[model samples]
Structures are given as C-alpha cells and as structure tokens.
Target: MKTMEQIRHLYSRAGFGLRFEDMRLVEQLSVKHSIDFLFRSSVQSKPLVSVKENVNYKDFLKDDQLSRKMFMMQQRQQEKDLNIEWLKNMSTGNTQLRDKMTLFWHNHFACRTLNAWYAQQLNNIQRDNALGNFRTLLLEVSKTPAMLQFLNNQQNRKGHPNENFAREVMELFTIGRGNYTEQDVKESARAFTGWGFNKDGVFAERKFLHDDGQKTFLGNTGNFTGEDIIDMLLAKKQTAHFICTKLYKYLVNEVPDAANVNAMADVFYNHKYEIKPLLEFVFNAKWFYNEKNTGNLIKSPVEFIVAMNRQFYIDYQNPDIQIQFQRALGQVLFYPPNVAGWPGGKNWIDSSSLMYRLSIPATVLNDGVIDFTGKTDPDDEAFIATARKEKKAVHTRVQTQPDWNKFLSDIPAHTTKKEIAQLVLSPAINSKLLSIINKATDIKTMVIELVSTPEYQLS
Candidate 1:
C-alpha cells in the first residue's frame, strides 16, 4: 500500500480518523514507524466526563417514591450525557487505538446497564484495560456491577443459582458456544453464588449465599470461587481462539480466515492474552493493508459520525443530535439492543438504513433535518421531510454545521478532485465515484459529493 493509504487504513481502524493535516504529517512515516507512533500517541487515555454523580443506591431506596422518581429522571439524563460525551471524545480525544479497542470490548462483553453510574463504571474498565491483558479485562468486566446486574449474577445465590451469567460467560465472552454444556453452566453458576455487589456499586460477597461445595467444571473438580471459574475459562486455549477470532473480524474482515486467526491465537495465547502484542502482530502483517481487508469493513454509527466530525470539522449544535442520529442509524452508543450487542457488518445496512446512512454527510453538512418517523426517504432539500411532524414521526432538526472553509482552505488550490477523493475516502475512488467527483463545480461541492457516496459508508 502507498504511505497515505496505509496511514488512512491505520487511522480508520485503530482511531476514528485523522484530518488532512494530521494525515499528511504521518503519511511520510514507514508503516512500522506509523504503527509505533499510533500506539505511542495513544499510550495515555483522555479523561472521561463524570457520568456517575450518585452511587449510594442504598440511601436511594430509603427515599420516598417521588424522590426515587426524580432521581431516576436525573439519572436518565446523565446516561444520555454520557453517551454524547463518549462520542465527542471519539471525535476529538486523539486516543483512537484505546477508544477503538474499548469499543470492541464494549460489545464483546456487552452489558446493557440501565443505570448510568454502573454503565460508566464498566465503560471505564473497558477503556482502562483496552490494551492490557484479556484475562484482566475479562475478570474486571465480569465483576462489575453493570455486568452482574445486567446478567443477573447479582441474584446468583445458593439453592437458587441463576445461570444467565454462567451461560453468557461461555456463549458470548469466552470459548463461544458448544465448547461447554448445560451441566457446565449449572456448575459454574453454583461456583458464582454469593457474588453480588453493594449499593455503592462495589463487589461484595454474601458468604451465607455461597455454596461451598466441591464442583466439577470443564473437567476440573474443586471448590471454585467466581474468580477461580474465570481462571479456569482463561486457561483453555479455546478462549484465546475465541477472542482472537472476534478481534480478527473486528479489526480485519468480518469473514474469518482460519490461517490468520490461528496465527493471532498463537500470538495472543503465547503472550498470555496481552492485547498490545496481538494488535501489533495484526497491524504489522502485510495482509492488513490488502485490498480486501482495507476498505471492506462497515463503519458503525459511532465511527460514521466521528469520521464526519474529524474529517470535516462538523459541529453538532444540539445536545441530543448524536443520539437522534444514532437512533436513526441503528447503532446507539451505550444502548445495545440486547446482550449480544449490535450484529454489525451487513446488519448495519438494509433498504431503510442505507437511505439514512447515505444521506448523513449532506444532512449534517448542509444543516438539514432528519425525520425518524418510519416514513418516506429524504428529498432534494437534504431531509426526509420538512419540519412538519406527523402523528408518530420522531423529528429532530439535525443541528450540524460543517466548517467547509476550515477543511477546504487547508488544501492547496492546485489539488485535483481525484487527490481530494483519495484523502477523503478509504476505498480507492471507482469509476462511478470519480464521475460524480469530476462533475463537481468547486472544492466544497466536490467534498460533499465525495463523502455522500455509498463507498464512504465503508472504512
């Protein structure tokens, strides 16, 4: 791959993206040096906004019904704020590798915590350990109140073991399905009894609730604690393969290649699940920049929105605009549809969603409105409909203003449309896109045309 294309690939997958100047600065570096710089630049995590103001759930229950209702209202808004804060960070934080890995783990260990405090806590865990060991990440995430509460491990007590946590730990988090059986789930649930959190969202154990009896799990017999069960799961080579396979799909291609996955599993397992080494291996491999892998993956909604902001310097005038766009696009941050998180890949686009996705660049840059009323498509005015709201149409005026002057002025006056298209798009501009780009009258028109194409939807 050319230097510019290589840097763009790294930035697109590892980080949200880079601006024209940012891309120019790194395009001269060798791929290895660029990878080093990317990792080095993201060594320190950017600060996250405080999403949890109140953690005293114990005291919260003592309050009257009205007090609880008011508190819940405040909490719900805080959750929304947390959602928007993360997006802004993704757009501007410069901690792309960490943030992107955190996003990967976010879905892998998916937990739909309704409480903002617990959700933020879990989010921190993912961010903090995004490049750390997988064993540590899994153990820490498993113990979080968000995971416990969401998976109902909070209710896993003696005599009545809740197997939801055990089942997901295998089926989703590690080893995948068919590696363990219903009996393993039952035994693991028994081991995890007494694992519950206090009102402060701290891990707490109810000794009386635990069953301290010999349990057989995955062919091992012992009085395994919840932590011990996690260790046992991690000890298996299959766990390494499961995580590497998912990582391969997330960072490389959605379709798994057995050879690549096997090599990844070797590096990941041999390193004792160290995240950095595994990623370094993947990034250093020549195949990572191959045509099939470079621009084939679909960008999630978060990625799509951040790319627009990072590339074009778009500003959202309204607080709820991101969430509204997320809802309309099918991938809302912090709100996974179910425990499996977003299906991703081809699931991100269908007949209805493709129309919305294709229209985002023009809609946001042109200050157009989006009508999420499950109605007709947007027209030439750059909106699904005008400000008029139907009886059931969810409407929001997308208060996005793109700084055309900021982006366009940076480019040299002599730059051609093809060069600009190369900078803006991950995929090489094809005949169709080249035709559209060539028809543009000016830089602003050319850029808008470049980004609005369907090819821009892919990385």
Candidate 2:
C-alpha cells in the first residue's frame, strides 16, 4: 500500500505536486474522495484572461524592417508579462486540477507563439479547454487561430493543400508515427483544406477555398469534412495507446512497462476518451504510488518554480526577473524551442541551464533586479496585483528582498535537514546532495543547498 506522504510526492512530481494545505486535505480524505476531487474540481471552464484585444493582425506584416522588428519585440514582451501573470494564478489559485490539466494539454497539443498577442491568446485557450471533453479539445485546437496560423493551416486550401497540420494531427496528436500512411495524410489534408480562422480569430469554413472533392482516407471514401477525418482517426485503438503511453510517461514513470501501458490504453479506450476517467483510474491504482515511481522523476522548469512559489507563498510583482531566469534556465515564455516543445524532466538539466536554475532563487529573493524597456513597467504595484489576481494584469516588481528565515518557519522544527532534503529533492537524496544538506547548520541553508543539488532537478 502507498503511504500518504508517498502519494503526495507522486502527485506533486506528476503535476505541480500539492500546496501545503492541499497536502493536509489529501491526507485527511479517503483515496476515493481524493481521486474524485481531481476530476470534479477540474470540470469548469477556466476564466478568460484580460488582454488588450482588437489587434490588427495585418500590422505584423509591415513592409518596413525596423517597424516589423519593433512590433515583434513589443509583442514578445507582452507575452512574457501574460505568462508571468498566469503562472501566479496557476501557483496560487483555488483550483488545483485546472492548472494541472492546463499544463498537461499545453504539452499535448503544443504550439509556440511567435507573437506575444497570439501566444497570450493561445495560452488562455489551452486553459479554457484544460478540463473539457477530449473531443472538444481536439476540435477546438483544430480551429484555434493561433494553431491554424502556427501550423500553416491558413495556407491550406483547395488547389494546393498544406499537409503540416494533418500530418501532426495523425503522427503527434492522435496516432503515433507509422500507424498511418502517406496516402492517409494526403487524403486528410484534402478533408481539412477549408478549416481555418476568420479576421476576428474565430473558426471559418470557406466553401470557395474548400476542397469539395471526395477523399479516400483509411479505406473510407466520402466527401469527408475535417470533423469526419478527426472522428475516423479517434476510432482507431492506436490513438488510445499513443495517448496512454504519453500519460504513463508523464503521470507514472518515464519508462512505462509494456503491460501497464496496455492496461492503461484498454481503460482509456473503453472510457470513450474522457481524460478524467483514465487519470482517476491511474491515480487510484495501487501501482501508481509505488516506491519506484515516487520522487524518481524530475520537475519541469515551470513546475519546479510554480510549486515552490505556491508552497512558500512567494509572490512576485515583477516576473521579469523570474522570466529572465526562466529564459536563462532554458525554458523561455511564449517560445517553445521547437514544435515538440521542451523535452522536460532530465532534459531540463544541462551544464549551462543547471547553474542558472541553482542561482535563480538568490536572484529573485536577494539582489536581482530585472531590466525593463518599452512600455512594460515593473515598478507598478497595482499592475503586479492585477497580474497575480487570477487573471491578466501587467507584472509587478518586488521592492523588498525575500526573507528565507520566515519562508521555512512553518515547517516543523522537529524536522531534520535530511527530511527537508527529502521534501524538496525530486530524485531523492543522492550522496552529493546528502553531503551538502548534512553540512548545513540550519533549515534555510539546507533548503537552499538541497534545491541547488542535482537531485533537486527531479522535483
């Protein structure tokens, strides 16, 4: 049987872990209640972010090089601000499963924002659909203006259809590679030709641009629509296995045994692709909290920082410093390095990035001050408050330094430095980390040193 503490650790590393109070709540609840809460709490649509809308999408294509570059830069800064604000709510908000599901879906249908406004919009959409029906998410993603533009679906039309979105939908999103053929992609491309967005960023099916000809997809011949193509793809058992394998790697262990994966796929497929059912079955499963899985994985940069901030009640008005640190730490806002998104876990640690991760807390809680240019104001406290208040607001700045002593005051005094190491370290305490924590005289130093460890990368 999994102990409560071990279960909490599993949940933490699997998602953002738990808040201190949440940990207490989970401790008190029956496993069924605890599991049910994960799904029930996530059933609502996330509140929309408040960003400056009515943007002219055409202005981005200005002929002047300087003007375009300036526009791109401003847009990038705005996206960073938006991301920082979202992070604050994600870390501190009342709803736990919503943020966790948002994180999961962001990786599921990963798209990067080249423009800040577009990225901010994309981020909000992902949050809105985080806990909705899987079919709804897939359909929403297909029509999302940001996705349509990012994957070049805007160029997909009657005569010359771009197959980028179609290829990804089959290969990356639904079924794994090689489950479908080149002919399937070509046919799917034809079906999705008219799936695009209007000027106001809403879905539009342009009949004039649509390929109305019959398409032979997966041995089925018909004048299939884009929705039909998706429906056909989901009917395959491979889609279930592909998604289950991903969930296993993320929520269970990185290296899932084949037997477990097959079982998960069976449950997922039988459940009609409702994500909550699969997850509840997994979290409630006896093997989910096994010793081999507990604290064995590493946290992604966003998860690492957000969990810590929430646990300590660490608030930042000016997320620029944190944002700069995030960039330095190899996971920048609005920009994913490529289409596949961040590899995450152990991949988040490298020689250059590791040093920056170790150094970030000091930067935020001590002497670090982020430089601001353009219209962004880090000194505006109201902006910071707005930014952190469950929705969109400009990021704020911190005039006072963080107090480490007060930060760990709530942790039991009876707790040893080793226990503190275990509480935060992702991969548990290896000798190097154990040595560092052992040498520390007090909880504050031990906390910092443990975070600075190689093991800390796992949290």
Model 2 quality (TM-score): 0.86
TM-score of each model, paired residue for residue: 0.93, 0.86
Prediction RMSDs, each to the true structure? 4.3, 6.6
Model 2: weakest 10-residue lDDT segment is 370-379
- Residue-by-residue lDDT tens digits, candidate 1, 219-309: 9999989888888888898999999988888889999999999999999989998999999999999888888998889998888988888
Highest-scoring model, lDDT: 1
Winning candidate number (TM-score): 1
lDDT scores of the candidates, listed in order = 0.84, 0.71
Where does model 1 exceed 4 Å of error? 55-69, 375-390, 412-414
Model 1 residue 42 distance off true place after TM-score fit, in angstroms: 1.1
